[model samples]
Target: MGEEMNKDVTIDTPYITLGQLLKEEAVVGTGGQAKWYLREHTVSVNSEPDDRRGRKLYDGDTVQVPEVGTFTIRSK
Candidate 1:
């Protein structure tokens, strides 16, 4: 299989929630989808399993989704 794509997301605030990031990145269609996605799949934050939809992702944090790709959080 080909390598997953890399995406950089910049937020104006200090941090963002996992669900927000997923929805913003279009990973999931809706908030409900983000919730369902988190429940059904394994999402890693900094290489650790992160199931919390509200998990705070600060600047420099890395979120890796096996199917989607990697998301790097940055402050704007």
Candidate 2:
């Protein structure tokens, strides 16, 4: 498969949770799905494997989901 494109996710807050990011990006329908989503999908934060729904992502952080795409956190 081709390399995934990096998409920017702008946030006004200091940080956003993994669940919130997934919801905002429309990857999952509801925040409650984050738990199951994490279990079924692979998520990495800054290249490190992370499966926590509450993982705090700050500006400049990178989230990569192999089945989906890469997302970069940006502050607005």
Candidate 3:
């Protein structure tokens, strides 16, 4: 399969949860799916393995899933 395109995600809040970011980016269809994906797959936050669904992502944070795409969080 071809790799998904990398993307930049803008957030208005002080921070966004990892699950929320996945859902908002349409990487996962629902919040539950996001959590399930987190549990089943490896996700990297700033090059470190991060599985916490509630992990807070602030501006400049980069999240990557091998099957999906890299997402860089930016302030809006």
**Top candidate (TM-score):** 1
Please tell me which model should have the higher lDDT, number 1 or number 3.
1
Q: Please give each candidate's TM-score.
A: 0.93, 0.91, 0.92
Per-residue accuracy of model 2 over 2-62 as CA lDDT, tens digit each: 7767799999999999999999988899988988999988899999999999999999999
**What is candidate 2's local distance difference test score?**
0.93
lDDT of 3 by residue, 1-76 (tens): 7977789999899999999988888878898998899999999999999999899999999998887889999999
Evaluated at residue 41, the lDDT of candidate 3 is 94
> Considering TM-score, which of the candidate structures 1 and 2 is the better prediction for this target?
1
Query: Which residue runs of candidate 1 sit more than 4 Å off their true CA positions?
Result: none
Weakest lDDT window of 10 consecutive positions for candidate 2: 1-10
lDDT of each: 0.93, 0.93, 0.91
What shift in Å separates residue 68 of candidate 3 from its native position after superposition? 1.3
Clashing pairs in 3: none
What's the lDDT of the predicted structure labeled candidate 3? 0.91
Rate residue 33 of model 1 by lDDT. 93
Kindly report which residue stretches of model 2 are placed more than 4 angstroms away from their true locations once superposed: 1-3
